[model samples]
Target chain A: MFRSLLFVPGNNPSMLQNADIFMSDAIIFDLEDSVNLDEKDNARNLVETYLLTTKELPKAVVLRINPVNSDLVDDDLKLLQTRKIDYLLLPKANKISLFVLDKILKKIENKIELKPTKVICLIEETKSVIDIYELAKHERVEALMLGAEDLTSELEINRTTEGKELLYSRSRIIYAAISNKLIPIDTPFTDIDNQDGLIQDCKNALNLGMKAKTAIHPSQLETINEIFSPSQKAIKWAEAVLKKAKELNKGAFQFEGKMIDRPVLEKAKKIIEKAKLFELM
Target chain B: MWQAGSKESNDCLITLKKSDKTKIKIDSIVGHLFHNQILNAVKDTLKSDNINNVEVLVEDKGALDYTIRARLKVAIKRMMKDV
Candidate 1:
């Protein structure tokens, strides 16, 4: 249900305090990359305290821990054992990483009597993109997030404004996620000031079947939410198709010179359902 | 001396020093209303950590119980590491 997941630096008190007020569907309190090596302990303590003490929370709370190979991963998991985190955004994720994380989570769940925190595998490395489907189908994985910036660096290519370099990886992730019934999250648009570019990027991702997108800044949430939600034109078409189907009361019929069948009707129903879910109906 | 946290809004800067007797000083924007609550947070954290002799100075900018406790915990850890 997340159209936008905003990353908030874990060590910033002001951002952590105001995380829930943002319009993003989820808050990703980032402990890796955003926090420096010296501030890792500080960030971990801050996030733990905030999550434990805050009475009100956003719809979803995701903690982006360091990679599985890092020493900080164990401490990060141990600290949040008693807290209510919805997802763990595992960076540099691969089959081995997922397996290791799954085992650790199982141990923590068994010991603390806590529910399993779903995982969102971050596909950034070239090796991961090659085995995206296996990572998506992992039992603990609920989503697959494309990390285009890291991927481009690994590919030894320059990422462009048009995102031509990311098309292959993006499509692979989307297909893998969709096949596994997991959410596919597009990468954040790096240029915050370029709203037009952001819109186009989101549209391209959506058209390719990405279910959601991550945002580095709060300002991008509005555009991402709007772009991902069911459009008014689609809703209207769905409603009309359903109305005609009801009137005709047949297995297949002609509507506006196009044949209407069960698949079309089901697609229309899904659109209407999504529109209702997003409160656009 | 060991310190953690910052002067940012909704955060508290905690400084710790080795001392013969435990002393906690709290300076907060919301001290007038939450002075005792802030004091309790410091005392509770110190007690839980079994810290008997340390000088704790909390410079708070409207931090909640959790922020104060967390800052204090980090400071205590740093102080203990040096010990």
Candidate 2:
């Protein structure tokens, strides 16, 4: 239920400690792209030390590690051998890469006698799109994020705020994640200055049935969380539906000239649950 | 020893040069206002990492204790090239 996942640069100590103030649903300690090439070890060590010392991290903690093919991946995994990380985000994830990562994680878990760490895949390449179903089927896979920046770069297409270039990929990801029961997280808007564009983009993602998005800056967290959380109107509708469902007691019913069936009931209940979780109820 | 990090707002520049007789010498360019806060933390971290003999030069740019400690560890590791 991570509506907004904030990416905090692993190498930036101020940003790492700033997690206490930001209200992102989840915080991704990025050791991949955010860390400079020579400072990979430094970033990994910093994150490990932070986790070991910090007492109360409000948001869900995720570690975005280097790609499977990179030389730094081993040391990155070594950090997990001793630290408690809730999730491991594999950058540029594909079928082959995930298989390799799965093996590595398994070995680490065995050596450390630690519990399984949930896995998240970054779907940003065309090859990954072709094999997304397989990638989503990983036992540890719990979520998938669309990395539009890298995806567009690979496709040699320009990304637009309107999101025309990412329609197909977005749709495919939503479908795959839904079918596999994985959470679908959208990419960051990348335009830190244009608040209006970010709002429009988030609304579009919500319309496309995405439940979460990554935030590069903390300012975007509020907008993303507000968009993804169940609105008051939605909560009211859910409450009304529950009341009517209890009254009906059995079978489908007609409400507002629309069919109120089991699926609709389930959606209403989920909306209410989300509202309660966010303490909006 | 070796050096790591930069003089960025949230970072520190640590220079670890080899020393003799297992003696530790620490000099700071911006450790006055905080008194012995940054240097003390760096010293503790160095001891915990089993680094006893080195000349530690710290150029603090308002880095947190964690940043300063991490920079020192990297500098020592690069210097030793053993761990």
Q: Kindly list the per-residue Cα lDDT of model 1 for residues A174-258, writing each as its tens digit.
A: 8999888899999999999999999989988998889899999989999999998888999999999999999989999998899
Alpha-carbon deviation at A241 in model 2, angstroms = 1.3
Off by over 4 Å in 2: B21-33
lDDT of 2 by residue, A199-280 (tens): 9999988899899999999999999999999999999999999999999897899988888999999999999989988788
lDDT of 2: 0.86
CAPRI class of candidate 1: medium
Predicted model with the maximum lDDT? 1
Shift of residue A14 alpha carbon in model 2, Å: 1.5
Model 1 residue A97 lDDT? 92
Across B1-83, the per-residue lDDT of candidate 1 in tens digits comes to 99999998888999999899999899999999999999999999999999998899999999878888988988888888889
Using DockQ as the measure, the top candidate is 1
Q: Which ten residues in a row have the lowest lDDT in candidate 2 chain A?
A: A50-59
